[model samples]
Target: MKQYELNTIPDEGYRQALASLLYQLADDDFILAYRGSEWLGLAPHIEEDVAFSSINQDTMGHASMIYELLASLGEGTEDELAHGRPPEERRNAIILEEVNGPGDYLIEPRYDWAFAVVRHYFYTVAKKVRMDSLKQSSYGPLAEAAVKINTELYYHLLHWQTWFTQLMNAGGEAKQRMEDAVSRVCDDFLGVLTLGPDGESMSRYGLIEEEAILASRWTEALKKPFDSTGVQHPPVIRSLRGDGRKGEHTGDLTDALHTLSEVYRLEASGTW
Candidate 1:
């Protein structure tokens, strides 16, 4: 086994669970950041575009950190692991890897602001829960990474929550659109909360807290703002699409994987 800069040895089970958790974290950020990258020059407003780009960059950086940890575990070098992988090899949630809207980013991209807000807001909340738990991870590297990642996430949560609330209250067309987005998001959110077949094992080994607790905390975090709006926000945790952590996903991820790896794939063996 490859050694890391940190010398803590969690049990074999804990180590394996930690690796699994890292993959989910890295993949989630990678795919969503890619989606956010697609929105780079196409946001409805310029200021929002700048703010959004910062978030995407932050997410990509976080993914890099996770990928580095994975590399330390002998998964592969970070560059090859990220650039040389095929779409089916990816493990990101389906919702995240989906396109911004009906059209492609290269052409007439009518991206939906509402969908972006809801999906990002919900995912951010879930990430906060997971990171909080990881702060107590038995593995020293993971706990340390959680501490660093938690700092950047503060801005992400605030930004997405602001957009979610503002858009929901924007009235008429905006409200309708947000509602539709909410419905779609609720349908597919199971992907984010899932921790794969080893979820229980992960919790038991202190890689993270129980999945139920994490999911509940996420719901509790969202409840306050949702209640204040007087909207019919359902409290149930729903995941219409199958869990991605278990290797189940939609074609959206396949397309995203192709694009993100495009530049890197051109010369994966060459140092850039």
Candidate 2:
């Protein structure tokens, strides 16, 4: 697999496809990390809180790398791309932007720990599948970035999977919460699996595998864990809300953008 540097990708279609893929990767992590940041001092335990924050930091760092790659390809500065982009411009999945729970994080945040665990667990597993395929990306820098990002995902996967398994086996309020969380997460989980409308172009250019293949691999990987919990996998994983890849999103993303870009928007031209 010969790798392609930014300057080497001469074809307009290939460049567009690669840039599209990069935006999807960048937005996914950026929004998810912001959501995770809302849980900083709000995790169940102190140790878990610290560990989860680290994962959030790592995820954000991954977003930064992808943004920088985009900058190299003549996209705006990373800060502009990360902070200045409107909700309609964001390529992240709708599931990632959803509020942690009912109330706002700063106010009476009755955040659901079970949903956090299940969402992160399911997302991390899917991420792993995606990253594995990305290692073979036609774009060299992206493939290399995938390799580096993958190094941190092991711990992320272990941490969430542990929580997921424990909560599933606890048998009581915990079991019920986790089960309910799984059902809720599944409702929007398929959005994370989709590669947007340009996904076929990405696949044709070897940016990543097709959406169906990635979804199948993710499902197969989770079968054992799901079986342990005694819940059969859903027959169809549909994007109930809307497709984020196509720039369609819910109000949740608008709220998240305001929260995340607050500081950046204030000093866009000033040095940090």
Measured by TM-score, the strongest candidate is 2
Question: TM-scores across all candidates?
Answer: 0.92, 0.96
Compose the digit string of candidate 1's lDDT tens values, residues 205-224: 77788988998898889987
Residue 117, model 1, lDDT: 88
Query: What ranges in model 2 sit over 4 Å off?
Result: 103-108, 234-236
Q: Identify the runs in model 1 with alpha carbons over 4 angstroms from their true place.
A: 1-10, 103-108
**Model 1: how far residue 256 lies from native, Å:** 1.4
**Model 1, residue 225: C-alpha shift (Å):** 1.1
**Model 1: lDDT to the true structure:** 0.82
Candidate lDDT scores, in order, read 0.82, 0.89
What TM-score does model 2 achieve against the real structure? Answer: 0.96
lDDT (tens digit, per residue) of candidate 2 on 131-245: 9999999898999999999999999999998898888988999999988888888888888998887899999988899999999999998888888888777434668998899
> What's model 2's overall lDDT?
0.89
